[model samples]
Target: MPKILLLFAHPRYEQSRTNHALLRGVGELAEVTFHDLYEAYPEFDIDVAYEKKLLLEHDVIVWHHPFYWYSCPPLLKQWIDVVLEFNWAYGPKGNALADKTCLQVITTGGGSEVYCSAGRNNYSINTFLRPFEQTARLCGMRYLPPYAVTGTHKLTDEELRQHADEYHRILISLRENASVADLKDCEFQDDIPPQLTIS
Candidate 1:
């Protein structure tokens, strides 16, 4: 059985319409543990030991957040700094996350077409996500294809609901008892359509 630990970070979740709906819709599942970093560490003081424990328990680790400055929210960077420690998360004596999987679930205010060389953002979403992929690689973790939901600001109600449902399905596919072929099929490489996790 695989345990999924979802690390959710949104500084102003209240002011958000799209991300809020996405998170809420997916929060109802059985084994999906959503850890709200902002709510958990309002003071910015993260308990590293406890967090490593969570990582140790879960088979897959998900960093869920909005695209803040083409990267993650500050709290997530802080979490990575504190939780993924040397001699614990990497380097000699570190094997905590060696075989575990790390995946990012992100929602962006920008449109998909705009995140390109000729676009305003001037980079693809996957290009901006290389750091995460490399980070997973450094820790000997399998970085799966990320789940990206774009154009949040313009999402219609039906579009939002559709994406929310897709989000739920993706998470459910990672939960304990989900098959291995399901995991392999997702082969994340950035800016791709949804993966077919099952037959």
Candidate 2:
């Protein structure tokens, strides 16, 4: 199984029922190293060397967070700025992260209907995630579609549990390299075929 590094960033994680349930689903997975950015760097002082080391050790990197104003939280942005350096992650000599996989797991308060061309947001979730996709490309990582749990403000406990179960199954599929093909053409990892994710 490939080692998976899940970089989780949520400033107010304590208050988010969605994130809490998601974590509970996959927190004990043996192949996943769950790194909570907010917990580690409360002062916003990121250790670039340590962060790079973590990246080097993992085959798949997961950027898990809430959709904050169409992007990630401030600390995750800062981590991107400092950890992925010129001579390390992008430029000619920056081949350390080449051939790795990048996945995003996100939650949104808005419903899926509100994220389309004719909706309130006026753009798809994929359109809003272009920057993250480009970042993974620049680092030579294969970026997969995100796994999104939308309509979070009104999701029932049962709905939340189902999403959480699906998340756990998705992680297992990724770890075992069992469903990469199914994930490639999906707009969201949530669209992955149920059969492909059988654990």
Candidate 3:
């Protein structure tokens, strides 16, 4: 099983409903380590060495957060700015992250329909996630298709539970070393791997 490190960030975690539920579904997994950024570094002081140690120890890295202004929360961005050092994470001699896999799990208040070619957002969720993909690439990590939980403002109780279950299923599949090659062509999922059949 690939050790997974989840960098979870939420400025107002107590006020979150969807992201919290999604977190609860995967928090207890065997090889998944959860690092709550906001709770750990309230002052935005990221421990670069410690975070680098975690990255080196884990085979899969997940950035879990609510989509804020089409990007990540402030602390996560700050974490990236500090943790991903020049000669350590990327440079002539930096290759510690080679062959590692990175995935983004994000929640959005807007419905999936709003994030399309002619929609209000005017782009897919993946379009807004290019920065993350490029960051992973620069560090020699494989950027997997993002798992997006959308329409949080209107999710019913059953819908929320369904999404959470899907999140759990995906985590299990990833832990079991399931091949997500089918995920290459897509960039988003209502739950997880929307059209990619993983067993």
Best by TM-score: 2
Q: Runs in model 1 with CA error above 4 Å?
A: 176-199
lDDT of 2: 0.86
Clashes of 2: 0
Q: What are the runs in model 2 whose C-alpha is more than 4 Å off?
A: 182-199
Q: Which scores higher on lDDT, 1 or 3? A: 3
Sort by lDDT, best first: what order?
A: 2, 3, 1
Write candidate 1's Cα lDDT for 112-197 as tens digits: 88989999999888889989878877887877777788988899999988877777777787774454356554334355344323
lDDT of each residue in 18-52, candidate 3, tens digit only: 98788885767999999999999999988888999
Error of 3 at 133 (Å): 0.7
Ranking by TM-score: 2, 3, 1
Pairing residues by index, what is the TM-score of model 2? 0.92
Error of 2 at 186 (Å): 8.7
Instruction: Select the stronger candidate by TM-score from 1 and 2.
Output: 2
> lDDT score, residue 123, model 2?
86
Per-residue CA lDDT of candidate 2, range 124-180, in tens? 888888899889889988777788999899999999998888888778878888655
Scored against the true structure, residue 147 in model 3 reaches a CA lDDT of: 86
